[model samples]
Target: MEIVSFEQLDSTQNYLIEALEKSQLQAPLAVIASEQTGGIGSRENLWHSSRGDLLFSFALPLSWLPDDLPLGSSSIYFAYIMKETLIEFQSSIWLKWPNDIYYCENKIGGVVTKMIGKNLVCGMGVNLKKNQKGFEALSIGVEPTFVCKMYLNGLDKKPTWKHIFRKYKLEFDYHKNISTHIMGQKISLHNAVLCDDGSLLINKKRIYSLR
Candidate 1:
């Protein structure tokens, strides 16, 4: 994988998208920044990136994945794969519904996926140290470089989307207070039903987190 590093940037996700759009960067490229002044978050929030935060954003052509892949669950698929890789290192890490990484009850990182033209861009952040925020750092220490390598490796596998969706669906029960917005309204996951495509069926409406 090709990587572009920056001492400081506005947002890794935005930069990566722009680079890919302009053909200034290629697929399977990772853009990492030491710090981000305008970090983005899923659910329309701001990601507060501080010192020691492992911010990563990568782009890949849509052809790299399976033909029947479900795009809405791309974030969960990538985040869960990262969690599984940490398990290989004997680290205790779990993923929340959709794309939030959690260590016990506290969140440690998050994943966001967007489709730009025919490419898929993934933006991720994992706090390695104290952030002085609501989220927690990873329970066990992991080298950022190692984590990035593992993530890219997982992406290379190009596992079937259904395979990933099945795994992620099993973990959704843990997030009892599902508070995600849908169609301009905050909807709880308690009454929502998890579907085979990794979407939620609430009030007969199918909702997906395709951010």
Candidate 2:
């Protein structure tokens, strides 16, 4: 994985997209920054990433993806990978349905995936050193580079969809458990299902579908 780090940027997402478009990089390029002035979030919301947060973006070629996997599943897969990595820090991370990452009821991070030409660009934001207002922070005692390294290590392995799904199932259980304990919500994990098209289902109801 190649990482391009910046001290400050208007938006890491924009920088990544522009870089990829300009350089015409083949695929799998990572863009990380210490601070992003105009960060983006899911559903067209503004992502308020403070200076201490971990913000990054990467581009992946669609040709490398598995034929059986749906395009929308990238976010879910990335979220699970991140949750697994955060567990190493003893941080109990939870997936709020599709892509939001919660520490304990409060959103600590999120993943966003966008399509640029024929490539998929994924952007991730995590509260590491500092937390935004109304958001919680997890002191993982690790730098963004280290986290990125760990993420790349796992991603480079190119685990099968079944392997990724197994990991997702485990995190989904953890998510339900944390929701029950922290939010007093009794959501059944059995109700949770991954649809054939990669949408997330709860109680057989479609909750979130990726782009």
Candidate 3:
């Protein structure tokens, strides 16, 4: 993946999407910033970020993705790769079901993915040093560029969905005590069954990550 670094940007995700749409940027490319003034978050929420945070967005052609990977669960697939990358740094970061990145009980970051033309773009924001009022910073210190490179390297490998899902299943027990929102309603995962495709079987309703 080719990486483009910046001191700051309004939103790396937005920039990549717009550039790709305008034919100004290409796939297998990444945009990283030291800070993001306007970051995109889940459910249309803003991901407030500052210096020392890791904010980046990467785009890739659909052909680069694993054949078995579900489009709707792309968020989980990419998010899990990041979690694995941080684990190599000895950080206690774990991916919350769907898209949130958490350290123990506090949220440290999140992931969002979107399709643009024949490419898929994924944006991630992790608090490496700075923290908001309710969120927490990363447990271990890491340079923003270094971590983004490491993550992109992992993504470049294109790990199969079955391989990633197998490991994610082992950790699903950690989320049973938590609840996730669906259609604006909070639903507990206590009885939710994680499907092989990364969706959750909650109350007999199959829910995709769809982030």
Highest-lDDT candidate: 3
lDDT of 3 at 20: 96
TM-score of 1: 0.88
Backbone clash total for model 3 is 0
Error of 3 at 168 (Å): 0.3
Worst 10-residue stretch by lDDT in candidate 2? 177-186
lDDT agreement with native, every candidate:
0.79, 0.74, 0.88
The model with the greater TM-score, 1 or 3, is: 3
lDDT leaderboard ranking: 3, 1, 2
Give the worst 10-residue stretch by lDDT in candidate 3: 130-139
What TM-score does candidate 3 reach?
A: 0.96
Q: Assess every candidate by TM-score.
A: 0.88, 0.83, 0.96
Residue 11 local lDDT, model 2: 78
Each candidate: RMSD: 2.2, 4.4, 1.3
Task: For candidate 1, write residues 1-211 as lDDT tens digits.
Answer: 8778888899999999998889888887899888899888867689886867788899888888777677887887788887887677546577766788877666778899999998899999887767666556763566676777787887788888778777776678766565765667776888778888777888898878676
lDDT of 3 by residue, 1-211 (tens): 8898889889999999999999998898999998888999989899987788889999989998999999999999999998998888665678888999888788888999999999999999988875556457874677889999999888878899999999998888767889877777888899999999999998789998889
| Model 2 misplaced stretches (Cα beyond 4 Å) | 131-134, 173-192, 201-208
Clashing pairs in 2: none
- Clash pairs, model 1 backbone: none
Error of 1 at 182 (Å): 3.1
